[model samples]
Every structure is written in structure tokens, then in C-alpha cells.
Target: MSKHPLLVRDVLKRKHFESAKLIAGQQGLNRQVLWTHILEIKDFDTLINGGELILTTGVGLQLERETQIAYLENLIRNGAAALCIEIGDYFNYVPAELVAMANAHDFPIIIFEEVVRFIDITQDLHTYIINQHQQALTQLDTISRTFMELSLMPNGILKILQVLHQDTDALFLFVSEDTKSFYYPIEAKKYLHLMEDHCQQLELHEPIQLMSIDKDHFVIIPVNGLGQVWGYLCMRSALPKPSDYTLLNLERATMSIAQILMRNRMLQERQQSREDEFILALIQGEPIDLQYYQSYLPMESRNLFYRVVVFNMLDYANTFSEEDWQEIQLQNVMFVRSIIKKLGFFPTVSVRQHEIIILAFYIAADDMEENRDSFNQAIQQIVARKTPQLFEQITLTFGISNVYQSINSVQQGYKEAKTTIQMQHNELASSIYYKDLGVYRLLLHQDHVALLQYVKDYLQEILLIDQKNGNDLYQTLCVYLACNGAKNDTAEQLFIVRQTLYKRIERLENILGADFLQAPHRLNIEIAVKAYELLKKTAPDILRF
Candidate 1:
């Protein structure tokens, strides 16, 4: 390329300088050029066009500290090559604020005294501009070539990272998902730990970081697709606060790279899912005994039997973005299957996340009991090893369905598993086996006779008060006491007189017995009330009591 390149120094050196004369020595204004007139010395913000190293007469331009600060800020944001204030005209000095802001942003401001022609200084610099333009084009061409070459390959993520590291000089690893701690371990050695943490962070949409493995600055660019972040590609560099423009540039360039990686991975997973379904269908065969699936079971149409084990993550559905959720599905599918394979549960069907179905299926019903310990152990391992918050910390409940001989039998197990999941909600932060979860106790504990006695007793107390006075004593108690005996909370809940509720409790407490009147005595009543929440449908008529 024919060269007329303007180096940073050349930019300052260009232009003919006539004899120097001082204008505003006190105000600290430097003029690089003397135009026929200081036509319009606009700040960088309003100066839309590039390549103008503007000049101004230092005369009454009104350089207040604030005005000077604004001018400097505008120049920095808009890419002023160097600030050249014509000090000879008016102000001779720069304000503390102006100088400080200028130095902070790195815009070089110059000064001049004698009248210099603007055209003489900068008109011939077109050759240098042309050379600069060509060099920029060459760099762009090179990056483009590298981008395309990397994009075409199958291992695009590793390939892109490898290429980027080679060019940019650093280590690259996908980001870890600890946002608060902001840990990022470069190099693939930390893959296992990252996977564990990534699983934990799946419920979150924001960026996460892991340990600072190598003690370098880290940044995560999300690998987002299908409206969620599938993963993040992490990079470590020397620059702590890389400019937004530079980061933006990297973001734009990496979008396609991330898209390719996510798309390729999703396609593979979806393909595997389809293939697994196909194999299950093939195993069941087309001429299935549909009756085995339909009548006796809640979900009857399945041809392949899958015994599901449901473990709820610590996070709720609301926490994950739509993208994070899909990624969760993909990840769970992979993780569960991998675990099963490791545990010698080969060729088993596994479903991930809030599925109407998830299982290790088609094994004989008799085999279910035998596999319980192994499955339980696998689940325990999942809980212990998976990074923080993989299972909903509230309860790590796993519901296992009974094995059915026919694919249709899966519905029975599925229904049972769901019930168990709900049943063992109390055992959050731990796992449960379906048969072991034992929902039958709920039925026994909430039997009609027991429920009727409790309701009838409460009603008698209500009616006795009602008989004495016509207040809706039962309803009032329910609402007020629903506050769990926080008298203030109850009063607030009922939007009624706290004194009145206190009076009602006093009158009712005597009927129930002295034991039920104390501060702690209300706890059993609270339990009974909450239990009623679960049992109300079974004892619908008693609900009024």
C-alpha cells in the first residue's frame, strides 16, 4: 500500500506553524491552527464528522469550569484526535477540571499563537488518511478470514478460542456461573468444576463466575440462543476494564460463533432424543397391547415404559429465562444418561426437569425393588457433587415410579411418582423413592372420621360463641389465626379489631382446654389448620366447619 499514514505523532506534527504568540497563558488554552476565523469550535458530541482537528479563537468563548469540562467530555466520546485551543485569542489557561478530564480521557489538546492557515496544516494529510484506511481494511480482512475459517469447522468453539488466544494472547475457557464471586478458571482443566457450577447457575440468566484459577481479569460472553443463554465463553486478559466499544466488537463477532456452537449442540441433543424415542418405540413394537397403557393408568398411550425419578432443582421456573430452561433440559438429559451409563443402567430412558415423564423404563416390575438402592445412590451422588443449588435447596425430593411390564404401565408409575413428589415436599433438599415416599400415610392421616371429629369439634366451639352472639366466629378465627399466631399478622390479615379476635380466642380457648391457650399452644392449631388445607377437598362438607 502506498503510504501516507498518519502516526499519532504525525497527526500533531503536520501543518505549517507560523511564529508562535501567546493568547490565554493564564487560562491554559493551546491553539494548533489559526483559521481565517474561528468559525465553529463545537465539542466532540455535536461534531458529527470525523477527521476534523478543530481550532478556535481563545477570545470570549466563555470557558467556565463546567463548560470546559463538557467540551473535553464531548471530545473524548466523539474521538477527537487532539484538542487544539487557539490560546492567542482569549483564554490563556485551562481549568483544573478541564485539564483533569482531558488527561483522564487522553485527548491531547495543543496551543498556538500566530495566525496559521487551516488548509496548510491539514489538507495534504489525505494521503496519510488513505493509508490509514487501507491498513484498517487489511486488518478487517484478516479477522474476517480467520472468522470464516474457524466458523466452517465442526469444533468451532475450541477452534475459535484457540484462534483468539493465539492472536489476542491469553487463555480461554467458557465462563463459570458464580455471579457474586465472579470466578473464572481459564483452560479446560476446570471443565468438571465448571460443569458442576454451570448446572447450579442454570436457573439464573445473569452471568456467573468461578474461582480465579490463574489470577487474570475475566469476562464472560454469553452463548445465547433460542432466547436463553445456553452457555458462556469466558476469556482472561490483562485489561481489567476493556472499553465497551471493544467488548461490543468482541460480542458482535462472537454472536455467530456462539450461535454455531449452540445450534450444533442442540441439533445433536434433539437428534439423540428422537433416536432414543425411536429405539424405545422399536423395542415396544407397533402392535402394542394398548389396553395395558390406557385403562388402568392415568397417562396410557405410551408404547415404551420409562420409570421416572424426579428431582426438583433448588430453583423455581420463574428464576430461569426461557433460554436457561431449554439449556437445563439439554443438560439434564445429558447428565442423567451419563450417570445411568456409569452406574451400569445401560439403555435406560431418562427425562430431565419438570417432565410429565422421567424414568428408567421397561425393566420388569420385579426388578424395581432391586434397583432401588443403586438409583437412590446415584441420586445422592447427584445431590452431593452437583454445584450449589442444583436441586432446590428447599427439598431434594426424588420420586421413583414403580416399574410396569408394559410400556402402558409407565402411567401408573408416573402418577405414583408425581404423588410422591408432592407428598415428600417436606423433605426438600433431599431425595425420596416413590415406593418409599409412601403417600398411603396421607390418606390414613387424613381419614374421613378423623377429619369429621376435628371439624365437628371446631364447629361446636364456633356455634357456642355464635349462639352467645351472632358473630361469624368460625370464619373470623380461621382468617385471624391463619396468621400463624403472630397476633399482629393475624389482625392485619383479617383487617379487623385485634381486641375482638383476642376476645374470641379467649372465649374459645376455655372450651378447648387450658393447654390450647398459650403462645406455643397455637402451633398445633396452626398445624391442624394447614393440614386442613390439604384435607379440605376430601372432607368438602366439613370445610364449612
Candidate 2:
């Protein structure tokens, strides 16, 4: 394998530089030398590029001690790799002031005890740098080919990261859009807090450099995928700055990541098209050849249990245009699939009618009660906890179904989950499982007219009272019941004064009859209010008619 260019110490080992002795800045012996130049004037700092060594006969140092120190500081600031001065040509020895400044700034200073021709030094170093550049190009070609092959493998980008961390001898990380999680080098857990400060900068998709509190340098290369930035390739090393070779390798690795991401997206899109077709058919109770859907639906479901989850992205459906929403739906399907994969199950994910539908397999449970706890923990921790905040401007509500033996029961589970979502009515909760929904499931199966009539029977007086009097009594009643009849809590919830709430409650009591707050009455009122809200949420246009 080709190696990086020579450092200042490497040049000192050369025959042309045999007369050179380090006088200061021993710590900077490892500074890389990209090229060498001869300086004959005091203003040569402006002529040098970073990482180049300056060889002079102290022509630039023939000034006041303070001015000489200033010139030395300017050369260091210009990023010259090191300074080599012929001592006998100037004052027979290096200046103490210059030596102190070089040592303090870790800027290497070399003294040539014997006269060395500047033409020969620059000639030999330039040839060596050119050779090193050629070697680097050769090595980059090999790395590009290797990464191309890796990108075709499973978890290819991660495989590239494994190789990269080894090659660069640095910490490598891939941070997702969320920035709260690490995608590669699972051991990156310790650096999360240090990395968070750089997340916003990463999203700009521009190259950035950051320094941690611990003074470590990080180079962030954003991985662009499909016109948007997907994540970042972060390199952290003990070197004060990365060498050009390291950056070249990082750029190549980033290209590989982008290629892998695009390929994975295309594959996902094709697979998602098929998966959606199968899932849409399954949920609609249509017939499908089991052999054809074998890839999307887990074969484990044939013996184990399965559950269906219906997720609705509330508040967001109204915000984005239909075309933009469609793209978001596809992205969300892939993201949800990743989250579900970590839950240790085979999941079939799809987008249907603006909602995400998932069918995931579960380990065979002896009885429903036996697996409920672990299943609920996974639901709460993995599915519910991670899905909502996965996208900005979108919060998700999940309706989950109970585990069933046969995959054929998936249709029933899907329907149950869909109804459970209506029961939730976009509540603040993350999810509502069908098994936990109790009587609401029974109500969902009942005739719509009967449920409507039941609600109107208990709420018609209050509804009509509010409409005729131009009051918000119906809303107040709902808040009061939600607050469990606590007057102060109800007032606070409604953003009203206590006295106003008391007056509203008194009016409600009189309008609905003095016994309205008594037993059975309150229960009927709560159920009626919930049904009314659910109806409006489920079919607002139908209720208008």
C-alpha cells in the first residue's frame, strides 16, 4: 500500500538535508512536507502555500529581533511546514528570540551548520513530493475500486466505514438526520455529546471542521444522497489537521456512500412498490398468491404470531401539498422499516391512503397473556418512541392490533387497528392497541346511526343550548368531564377564570336538569361527548349532512 507524503523528520533523513539540525519545535517533527521552496526576501511569507518547507539564508531574518520574530510568526501563520536557516550566512547561530517563538508555537526551526545549495534541496524535495503524489493517486484508485465492491455488499456503507477507520487510524462515524443516534462504529456512543454541537452544520451539506472541548479536530463530509443530504462521514484524529491524502480518501469514501445510498433507495423503491401492492391487497381482504408475497411478508408468520399497526401522521397531512406528501410517505415507509427491523422481527411496511401500514411477526407465544409485557415494552420503546419524532413537522399516532396465529387474520387485525385509530381521534397519546381499547372496539362495530343517536340523546340539550345561546357550553362540558369535574382544573384547561367556569357549570346543571351531575348521568355524558368527537373526526362531512 502507498503511504502519505514525507514529514519534516523524513526530509531530515535525506543526504541533501544531512547538515540540517533541529534547533526548536521538536514536537512538530511530524509535520507533513508537501513541497519545498527557497526564500531570498523578507516578504516571502506571502509566497508560500500551506505545508511547504521554506529554506533561506536568514535573508528574511536580517532585521530587529522583534521584527524577525514577527516574520517567523507570519510564516507559521501562513502554514509553512517548517523553516530551515543557514546559520553561518546570518549570525553564525540561530537567534534565541526566534528559537523561543518557534518552540512556543510548535513551529519547527532547522539550522544548517554547513552551507547547502538551495537549488539542490528544492529539486530533490519537489521530485519526492511529485513521486508521493503519484503514489497517492495509485492508492486512491485501489481504494475507489475496493469501496465500489463494498458498496455492492450488504451494509456496504458500514463496511466502508470499518475499512476507513482502520486506514485513516481515526474515529469514523455516520450520523443520521436525527443526530440523536449513530449509524456506524457502534462504539461511537461515547462521543455523542461531543458530536451534537456539529449536527446543524452537518445538514448544510458543506464540508466543515469542528473542534471538541477535548481539543480533538473533526472533519465532517456530508453524504449527499438523492438530491438531499442523508447523513455525514465524520473523521476525528489526533493530528492537528488532516493531511490532503486523508481528505482525498474521505471524499472517495463519501462518493461510495452516496452510490450505495442511491442504489439502496432504488432497490427500496422497487421493493416498496411490490410490498405496497401485497399489503394493500392483504388489508383490503383481496386474494394473493402466498408464493409471490413470500419476500415481503415473513415466512416466520406461518408458524409464529403477527400483528398489524396503522400509523397516521396527524397535523402534517394538512400542511404539505399532495405531491410533497407523497414523497414524504415513501421516505417515511423506509424509515419506519428501519426502526421495526431493530425490534427483532420481520416487518412488511407500506403506505396506503396517506397512512403507514405495517405487519410485523412476533415470537410464538403460548398465550396472549404470556407475551403481552415484552411485546408492549417493544411497542413503547421501539415503535412508539422512535416513530413520532422521526420526521420534522410530523407527529405519528399508532393503532396496534393483538397478536394472532395465522397470517390470514391480518385483515381482521388491520381493520381493528384502523378502527382503533378512529377511537384515538388524534389524541396526545402515541398509540392505542385494540386490546387496550375495550368498549370502543365494540362501539366501532356497532351501527353508526345507533352510536350517533346515543350521543345525541345525552348531548342534544347541551348542543342546542350552546348553538341557540351563542355559548361554548358543549366544549366546556367536554373539558369539565376530561378534568374529572375539578372546577379549577377545568378553568385552567379552558383558559378561563374560576368564576366564569362556575357560572357555566351552573347553567349546564339547570339546562340539562338539576340531576344531570348525578350518578350514571356523568358517565353517559362522558361517553356521548367522546362519541361525538370521534364522529366529527372520522367523518366530519358526513356529520355536516
Candidate 3:
């Protein structure tokens, strides 16, 4: 809050006033000026201080209309609380031209009775100003507590609005350069569409300033701290003519808290943004020791494995905010983690929209196959919990990679999980594993880089060759992977009878490899098939909201 001169109204009521401009004299009378906050002076181009009285005879007024306009313009432009023009000089009345402009602009224009010197008003008004300034300061403690409660602690910017709306009794808006609502206390907080016409006077036109709202009835205080404007403050119920100390002191009182809140809000948002970015980076590539997740990793884990679950979200164009989707992903991922933990597999979840990822540590390679069912069941339970019951069209397929001895194997794990999903033969498949993938599934056979590249090339192959025959390829792979490679089970699983299964298997062996039907040959084919399946499922469909 600025420290305005005390008793300015009473001083104006006196025969002579003592504001900074009045004290500076009507014409040249060399004297060092005090008051700094009241920048408004007639043709006063310099930045202003708020204390002292500015007194001018009709000398400033007798100048040409443009000069008079410029003089008054500067005083009002600088945010002078009251303009005192003496009736003794030039004429006893305020100039019609100046009055019209001042009335239209609403810069306070006060005409003293002219029977006394302006200096007499200053002496009388000063003590009254001091008392009021002290009283407003006494309320500081309550203001601080109220501001903290009403404001968003996470976004310090909230403090500014809280002060403006709650304490100062004015609606508040935090606007961006585009004049859109960066934040607002009122729902109807309008954009700055009328800035050029309505609110420019209060505009410091520099970095920060406090000016009265039009008609001199309210103050629009700026909340610019740390060299950035977090937003603006609008104060209501301005006095008919406030003392200098009232204006300046109130400004000074509010200034510190507003700035501190803005700085805090900026810092908090930055932290959240960085945390989100780190999580996203982990999902896109390999997991790392990101600080937020580091403390949460499974302790005493010997071997860790991951399951990559990419949601093939339908109707991306239908959703508007990323925040909503990310929230859904978080809820579902937590649900999946909880279910897996209940079933005794330690799960750590990391996620972003359209992609839900989980890393399960403390399970050895030998235990992976044994626990795979519980893992699948846990994921299924997660879908039931997080997603709405009516969302039957949604699917939650998973890609489980063969357990790797190292955490760096997250890449492979992701690939395998995706393969499990891709090879499934359903338009809306959910909660699947890579081991369930089959022959045309080359993804599991390759490393991360090779697998992604292979899928890209395969898609191009289809596009170039114009082949539409993959329905069978997809089915064969699904059956083989789902049944875990026993020829009888794979055939029985598809319910195709053995001979037809055998023929389809033979065709796959021809395209993928002649050795695919044999022992070691089948082993390599399974890996390639699994890798391809995961890649097909995960890599092809993910998209933005």
C-alpha cells in the first residue's frame, strides 16, 4: 500500500492546501519535492511521490488549452488524488474545457474557496492523515490470515484476488497479455477488452502503479512482484476525497503480501509442470530416478519388471482438457497398483494420458510366469474400479515383457506388454500380456529401437503392397501367444480343430520363417511374434486429446 498524505480532503477544504504539487508552488519557487506516490501533476511528466501538496495559481491554467490539458493530463495520468485550482487566479471558476475532460476522465478536481493559503490546509490536514494511516495498518494481521485462507495456497496468485475481493470488497481478475482470465474471483470476470478506453489511467504505463477506477471511485492496484504482473487489484468504496496518507499508506500495506503471493504461485506452478514433464519423459523412453517417484520405488526388490499399458482412447477429439484425461489415467493406474499389491506383487505406477505404465519390482524372473495371471486379474479389477460402469466400449489391454534382471529392461517390458495387447483379436481388447501374442507378432523378438522401426516399416509394407489379409495373421498370433505355444492348446484355444490350425501355422512359418514350426525355430519365432504384437498394439494407436 502506498503512503498517501494525511488529511488531504481537509487540507483542500482549508484556504490553502499542502500536497506535493501545491507545495511546489504555482510557478517557479525552487523547493525539493517530497511525496512520491502521487505521480499525477499538471504536465508533470516525472514519476510521482504520494505525500505533500501541489499548489498552483492560475498560471498553469492560463496556458493554452492544450498546455492546460497536458498539465491536468499529467496530474491525473500520474494518479494525483485531488487537483486543487485556486479561484483567485485567471478566473474564479474551473475552466469549462478542463472540467469537461476531468469529468469525463473522472480525475478528482477540487477547487478551494481561495480565501486562505494552500499551506494552511496542509498543516491542518497532516495530523488527521497520520492517525488514519496507523489504524489501517493495525488491521494488517487479520488481512494476512484472511488472505491466506481464501487464496489458493498452491497458486500464490490467489492471494491477490483474495485481498481484492474479500478484504477490499472489489471483484478481481488476473489477466494475461491476451486479456483473458488467467484467474478470477468472479465468474463473470471480464477480459480487458476496454483497457484503452476505461482503465488506462490506473495503468502505471510503467511496470507497476495504483490508479483509481474511473469516476475516481475505486483503486485498481497492480499485483506485480518479481518484475512480473501476477494480476490486478480492484478496491471499492473509495472516499469522496481521501487524504494522501490514506491512498499511499493503503497501497504500501497491501503491496508486500501481494508480491510474495505472486512469487510463490509462480514457483508452485513451475514445480508441478516440471514434475509432469519428468513423468512423461519416463513413460516415453526408459524410467529413471525421477525425484517424485524415487522414494516410492519398491524397497528390497531383487528383480524388477514392468508392464506397459497404453490405453487406446477412443474419441480423442471429444475431450477438451488434458487435465481431465490425465486425472483419469492417474486414478486407473492407482487402482491397478492397489489390486496388484493386494495380490502380493509390488506395483509402482507411472502414467500419462492414453498410456498407463506400471513397474513391478521384487518379483524374480522365475516367478513372472507364475504371477502373470494375478497380474492380469489385478489389471482387470483396476478397469472395473476406475472407469465408469457404462464405458463398456473402453478396453484395457496390457503388454507384459519377459522379466528382465535389470530395471533398464523397462523398454523391453513396455514392448512386451504392448505386444500382448496388439495380438489380441478384439476391437476393444483390455488387460492383456505380451506372452499372449503370436506369430505375425515380431515385436517381442526385437529391442526397443528395432521393434519400433519394424512396426513402422510393416505399416508401410501394408500401405505399399495394399494387402488386406492380416485378419488371419492377427487371429493366429493371438491364439498362439494366448495358449503359450503348445500346438494342441493353441489349436484347441482358437476352437478351429487341429488341422486348420496346423495349416494356418504352416502359412505363418512360411512368411515369418521356415524353421518356425521346429523347437529352436519356434522359440525365436515366439520372441519376434511377441515383440511385433506389443509394438503393433502400443505404438500404432496413441494420440493427443
Candidate 4:
């Protein structure tokens, strides 16, 4: 338990202090007094320490108005809790300039109308200070035990905030690292921005630093775990400053919060481990007994048609280092989970090395087409709402699959989603459905390997040349085919002038043999381009050959 001091207001309530009149710094009555020092010397500022109430007859302070102001400023600078001057013994009145200074800095100054012995005042106040300290220690021990009990309970952040609210009667806020949202008692949600602003101050100051907002003081404790700051907790009170015991309580609460977060994270990791196993089973076409994984499946998925949406982080490879990349992916996974829940979808989200697999369920409705549209709309809504909040330079390629009736059919759906992802053009679309890539499916038949090899052989020279020159001849050939070999349309689609498209085509013909654009050879080029795309999509390792 940490010690606390008595405030000036507490001193005013004492029997010995009744005759003392607060002539200035009325706003600072709540400042805590660590001790009362009776000093009549001019250089007492050097002899005393902070939080000391200076009790004197103002003997050395009766000087020029400027000197008196300087002396008062020195006391303020030295952190005197308050200055009490016995008016009858000194000049008839306290200087107006000194009073002005006292009021301006909120440095409490009390005037004694009657001659009160400084010794008696000091002795009585010191006794009270010791008693208050001892009583505070007892209260601190009780609070520490209460905190331990609360931490061990099955409750979470809200429960923690509630206990603190009862203890301090002050609003509590918990801000996560993203600064985008926070947690508060439902009654205190109105002060969310106030919490966020205090969080920013916490980040600005050293951890454990105390700060204030308006009339309230706060202590911000960063919830640290495993060498990283997960978030922060802010305890704001109108008590001028938190008592030492209250500060200690905040420290203990922070440790408890960290424990809760770590425990929750461990639990989530275990749960996700099981979820990942189920996802892998579904992706591998393993026979799923509905009853076996029933607990893992959301209500929307039971006995319903389900499809897959694979969101590949396009910028994951180059944007972050290995350690940072993993953390970023984890955060994105959690973020996606929260957003899906908010969107009113019970999503089964699984994280792969670079992609997040989302199994979206479609419950049969009166109108199947309308249900499909709703499902599609959900995915689109996510892309629209969440795209901007991702890493600034990051973009996601969303690949969705056609819904399948049986859970076992999800393996094919997974492949379709992956294939759709690989078919992404240089266009601005963030999502693509497998049905949109119908032409590419023709290239994925039994002869896919041979056909893929043949296409590679057909375009090998152009592919190699493009790789060497950092050019897009292979892509140009694909676009030209996709545009039906029309130069103007391909040029427009490629966002290049006709002259540039003509140059690329000329280069393609030279490397791919002069007959590359002939009707019969053109057909081969088109098939080979489509086949190569299919190979890269379905089996990227084949392209190494």
C-alpha cells in the first residue's frame, strides 16, 4: 500500500485552522500537503521540499511589491503546497500583487486574521497527516485484495472498469492500440473521445505518467504483454490528483488487465487452432460428419449452402518485415472477424500464410436469388467499408466461389476461389467471383499439365524476354486475346495509346514467331495464354519450369 497526504481542504476542517481565511488560490484547496513547515527566513525555498505548506508571519516577505511577487513565485516554483501568512504580526494586509500572483498560479494562500501560534498549527497538522497516511494504508490493502479477487473472476474488461468506477466514482476507458475504438462502461460511452484524447497523451508521455484534462486528473497505464503494448487503460478522477493508494490500484489493475488479455489470447489461439483444423478438413475434401464439427459451425452454416471468400493480402510480401508481417496478418485477422460480426454474419475466419479464408454460409430463403444477392452484397459491403482502414499501401484481392450444397464440395469451391484470385487483372476491382472466370475453367481439364507445358513452350521466348526487360509482353498478349485481338480495344483496355500497343504487338510477334497473330496461330496464342494463366493460378510451382 502506498502513502497519501492530506489536502488543504482537509486542513481547513481542523479545529486549529478555523480562524484561517483563504484569501487566494481558492482553486488549489485540494492540493495535498505532505507536511507543514514553519519558516520565517527569506531563503526558505532552498531549505524546504515539495508538497510542504509554508507557515510564517510574512516577516521576510514584506518588501517591494516586485520582491514580494518574486518571493511568492519562488515558493510556487519550489512546489510549496500553500502559503499561510499571519496578517496581525506582519504588514496590515497581504500585498495585492502577491494575492494576484497566488490566485493566478492557483498557489493556495491563507490569511490568519488572529495571531495563531505557528508551532501549534504545525504540530496538529503533522499528527493529522500521519493518521491519514496510516488510514490510507489500511484502505490500500483492502483495495489490493479486492482487485485480486476481481482479476481472478471470469469477468472481462467491463467488470474491471466497473470495480474501478465504484472505487473512484470516475469514468474509466480502455483504448486499444489502433485508437479507432475503445471500451467503456455503457454509462460512460458518452466520454469516448475524452478517453481517446487521454490515450494520445499517454502515448506522448512516458508510460505511467500522470496527466489531467479539464478539472480531472488521470493516470494512463499501458497494458503491456510479451514485450509489446496491447492497449492502455485510463482512470480519470476529479480528485485534483489521485491518492498514492489509488495510483497503486491503477498499477495493479494494469497488471490484471494484461493477465486477462494474455489469457484471452491463449484461449483464442487454442480455439483458432481447432477452427483451422476444421477449415483444412473442409478445404481438403475430407468427409465431414455434421455432428462432429457442429459446435464449431455457426448456425447459418448448418445444413446450408456455403461458399468461400479468399482475401489475399496483395502488399503483404513487400510492405512489412517477416516479424512485423506476421503480427500485421494476425491483427488483420482479428479485425476482419470483428467487422464480420458487426455486419451480422457469423463468419468462420481462418488465416493462411498470406490469405484469410472466410466461409460464408447461405441459408435457403423463400427466394434463392435474393439470398444469393444478400450474400454477395455482404462481401461487397465488407470490401467497401474495410478497404480504406487497412495498411495505407495495402490492397486486398477477394476471390469468391459459387455456392455448393454439400460441405464436401467446398474443396472445389476453395480451388475456384483461389483460381478467381489469380485471374485478377490490372483493373480496380477488389472482388471477383469464380463464375466470372468461366473461360479460364476450360483450360483446367485432364490435360492441364501437358496443355500448361505446351503453352509455356509456346510463349517461353516472350515470357523470358519480358522478364529480362521488366516488360509486360506476356500480359499484353493475354489482354490482346481477351480483347479478341482488336488492337484499339486492347490498347484502350491496357490504358496505353495505340502506338504503344502496336509496338508491344510487334515485339510479341518477333519473339513468338512471325505467324503469332495469324488466325490459326492466333487461336493457339489465345489458348496458350489462357492455359498459362490457369497453370499459374492452380499450380504456381509449375511456372518455375
TM-score of each: 0.44, 0.60, 0.32, 0.51
**Candidate 4 C-alpha lDDT tens digits along 1-545:** 23545788888888878988999999998787889888777776568888899988878777777777777888899999999888865757887788888899998998888888888888898887778778877876777677667777876566778877777777788787432344455756766777676665554436676676677676777876544466788776676567777777777777877777766764574468767778888899787677877776666444466678788876566666887766666656665665555444556778877788987764664346224565566656556545333433567777888876666777888998887887774332234877766556666554766876787778888888788888988888888877777888999889999999989988877777777778888877777776776666566677754
What are the per-residue Cα lDDT tens digits for candidate 2 across 1-545?
12576899898999888767899999888988888888767676558878889888887677788778778888888998999989875747677888888999888999888888888989888888888888888888898899999988987877888888778778787766532344346665567655655765553624655555567777777776433456777877787667778888988898888787766664666566788888888788898898987887655534477788888776676677887777667766656665556556678887864588888776654655235554566556544434332455565567888877676788998988877776667551234778877555566566778778887788888787777888999999888877778898899999999999989989888877667667788777777776776676655655522
Summing lDDT over every window of 10 consecutive residues in candidate 4, give the lowest-scoring window: 384-393
**Global local distance difference test of model 1:** 0.52
Best by TM-score: 2
Give the runs in model 4 whose Cα sits over 4 Å from its true position: 1-3, 10-22, 25-27, 33-81, 84-92, 96-107, 111-150, 153-241, 244-248, 261-281, 284-339, 349-357, 361-409, 417-446, 449-527, 530-545
Comparing 1 with 4 on TM-score, the higher-scoring candidate is 4
lDDT head-to-head 2 vs 4, winner = 2
Instruction: List the candidates ranked by TM-score, beginning with the highest.
Output: 2, 4, 1, 3
Best by lDDT: 2
**Residue 282 C-alpha lDDT in model 2:** 79
Q: Against the unseen true structure, what C-alpha lDDT does each candidate score?
A: 0.52, 0.74, 0.50, 0.73
lDDT of 2 at 535: 70
Scored by lDDT, model 2 comes in at: 0.74
TM-score (C-alpha, index-matched) for candidate 2: 0.60
lDDT string for model 3 (421-453, tens) is: 555544333436555444544433556666655
